[model samples]
Target: MLARNDQNSLRRTPLYGLHVSLGGKMVPFAGYEMPVQYPAGVLKEHLHTRTAAGLFDVSHMGQIALRPKSGRVEDAAKALERLVPQDIMALAPGRQRYAQFTNEDGGILDDLMVANFGDHLFLVVNAACKAEDEAHLRAHLSDDCTIDSLADRALIALQGPKAEFVLAKFCAEAPSMKFMDAGPHKVDGIECFVSRSGYTGEDGFEISVPAGDAERLAKALLENSDVLPIGLGARDSLRLEAGLCLYGHDIDTTTTPVEAALEWSVQKSRRTGGARAGGFPGAEKILSQFDQGASRRRVGLRAEGRAPVREGAPLFADATSGEPIGKVTSGGFGPSLNAPVAMGYVPTAQSALGTQLFAEVRGQRLALQVAAMPFVKNTYKR
Candidate 1:
């Protein structure tokens, strides 16, 4: 449940005033004054972003650089993999991967994006957990690696159907890049690292630019009528429909990647590797869960009624009398579906597709049926 009122104590993004002037409903998120919705509202924002483009201020996320003492890309990847689960050594140049910072108990401290930047590892971690993640990485990283937070970078996500077209106005060579491919480029004279990856399940780009030039770049993007400023409200719903997990809400330190249905992020090569093996904290339990299976699993749900089930809603075995099975992590009125939908965890026995569960919403249990993820068909351009 989101309060309409503002409660942010953090700073504002460069486009804060621009968003407000465009009728954006500002709200506090991850310690930043961000837009939750615009004059078009969540539904229109969602659909517009799907059919057109939406610019998002994800600058609140923590950006950091990991440099190797050897200053070689290959050796740096090897040293960094010791702290994560992915096979960084195999990650091709200009490629990115989703990874987690894990604790000693196989719990995920935070989920982050790792981009192989030739000679450095570019990381974008959750702002709220950035401090802790940095400290943990610093404490465990071998002397061969040096971790430094980039405080002067701003991240902006240009997402949707026309995202490539919009981004092309800046980088002429970006149109041919496939998803997860990234490289250094210039956007309106400002140097940036652009990646063709996003959370909206649409063809998009995440641009990392100097903080001083972020405002100019954002304005340049908005010059296209096809591109609108979307707030956090629509961002959340979009990611939800895409079956993308949100840290702190859908996953936490107690949740393992395997349990969270994110095993794809781990490569088999890394699982049985040389220097860059899966040697991070709690590797035993994580590996065991992979082999034997987990007790509960994350799943998507379709509500029987029009009533929107929200986060923290309790889930039960049946509509009548059954103990709590799991809980909703992300739920909302899906703009694409024009109906209420949700995603959450449930016992493995009850996680099968079409299995029925009841979500307790407003003192009444609403029948919810298990469904395949991505409530809306993804429109990524291959």
Candidate 2:
């Protein structure tokens, strides 16, 4: 849910009217009319999600299916591995993994999710970069593979501690899912693809259902006492607090997975000394950085005071430092932590835990310290 100014040409999600009726403050985000916050405000929404379950409409994201004409699922996986650094061939059926598309120069194109659905590969890319991702996939993949865009589907994220409890009422198998596990299920007679994964660093499920059944499923989920509608504002704050990256902000075309502290997403099977190594784009550069660390790395920051240091705030080595050492990519008040939290890139030497730094905000330098994320503990059911 990347925030943007309202545009007259913005598209609407399947749940747009439902959001409006629930007092959601609609705004443009990723070229769609999305809800940034509701009447409950961001503060309450963020806290409530930590205590209960929050339903998020993430239908703006692009969902794609890659199938091999020869009917070999491994063929589709191998083709996808050519575009991303993850070991797609190693992914077991009904499982998902995080991955990134890299450019020839080792810069990140976009971060995405790849799931194995037994017969085809399921992909979920960021809304803003979906079109470009599709184009890149079609141009590079072999003729034997076919790319299908799932435009008639909608995605919903049910996140937080109580997510499984509420979802299990409709689907008996919801509570038994482990993190990153995905499978087909029926929720209140609506067929859905359910994955026990989310962006909030909590135990949850992401459901992909037919667009026509989106409202019905959402309404049924809301019937649970623990489930409440959450908007983009709290969603942003929650992910930030969880130390997750926002595509355009914390990561982009100019940043590589290594520089963005995402080397873990690149599996060992694709790295040096593995059976299949150096096959993806920019393999030389990305693998080199894995051995010799990146010059600058992304790190979490904790402010000294309650003042929120926002994105673009210049970071300095000390209070009276001369020039900016780095800049804040994502920063804001974390309601769950009851303090200001942020994430940004800094020189590797200054990225260690407890390293002291300063941020320039409103012409005054405020003290900041490199801290360990997440600001709130992750409660995933691993």
Candidate 3:
């Protein structure tokens, strides 16, 4: 979630004014001047999202569209299959899938969302990796599709159990959308790409609307009594509690999907013996790991005390052992769970649900246990 851009080079989203008006604490994140939290604070904002609804401005993310030259979405999907390991060809229109762009060594370049829009394909990549991702797409998939970056769009996430009720007020189709459904729809009389998916493990909708209409749509959503303006602070904690991977932390160029415990996302069609299998990057090594098993895997961690085991903390198999066994990639206090939860890579043998471990924090090794993820339960709309 960190970027190299300095404060002076930071960009602002279309809802910057609204955020400031709502007393949001602005901070530099992913090369953008984003709200870290609102006047209600991170803790309150987080709980509000769980009980009611929270609105988040995610405009910093990269949005791209691919129009197939042949005017068929299958053509565009086929073109994209060469980059990601997911089965893009079979992704039904209006449905989106979680995907990863991998390098030749099976290490993840970035994880993104790919949505089929009937005539074209829509992609939402991480903010920090957007430039490289767009360049990658242009360099490889340009021949079969017209790549268009949607710079004039702004994305907002309305997340929580009450999100559907709040959104259904303006968009009649909001309630009909199941998880991962994405397509064009009118929200508050403004055109938008509405998706029933979110970073937080809540039933929510991500609305991609025209930049000019972003503020208006956001205001409309916030006007609801159940909706509060949320920020990056809550977003991080929410996703962390949901056991979701942050791009640069939990997954990156140095980690493969299998080692990251994200093999569930790699569809059967891309595995060995399936039609059109192993054509994507890192196919050989990734396929082998499906059976061979990765030496280390990502697992959830539950700290022994109130103090949070932060990222970069060295993990150990034994409390007194001087040698490091693994490392914490993401760790924080989960508001919903009211405890310190973490995720990190550990030996495959140590990744089981009740394995014991230790995390070195502030020069002291703290007891940690490999625990079940979603520190909070997921409440997606089917």
- Which numbered prediction scores highest in lDDT against the true structure? 3
For model 1, residues 144-241, the per-residue Cα lDDT tens digits are 78888887788899999999998888998789888888778888888998999999988899999987888889988999999988889899999999
lDDT (0-100) at residue 342 of candidate 1? 90
Pairs of residues clashing in candidate 3: none
Candidate 3 Cα RMSD (Å): 2.2
User: Per-residue alpha-carbon lDDT of model 2 for 73-108, expressed as tens digits?
Assistant: 999998888889999999999999999999998888
Q: What is the C-alpha RMSD of each candidate to the true structure, in Å?
A: 3.2, 2.3, 2.2
- On TM-score, the candidate that comes out on top is 3
lDDT of each: 0.86, 0.91, 0.94
Q: Report the number of clashing residue pairs per model.
A: 0, 0, 0
Name the candidate, 1 or 2, with the larger TM-score value. 2
Candidate 1 TM-score, C-alpha based: 0.95
Residue pairs with colliding backbones in model 1 are none
Model 2: worst 10 consecutive residues (lDDT sum): 1-10
Model 3 lDDT tens row, 1-382:
2222454888888988898899999998888999999989999999999999999999999999999999999999999999998999999999999999999999999999999999999999999999999999999998999999998999999999999999999999999999999999999889899999999999999999999999999998888999999999999999999999999999999889999999999999898676688899999989999979999999999998999999999999988866998999999999998999999999899999999999999889999899998789999988
**Per-model TM-score versus the true fold:** 0.95, 0.97, 0.98
**Which regions of candidate 2 deviate over 4 angstroms?**
1-7
Give lDDT for model 3.
0.94
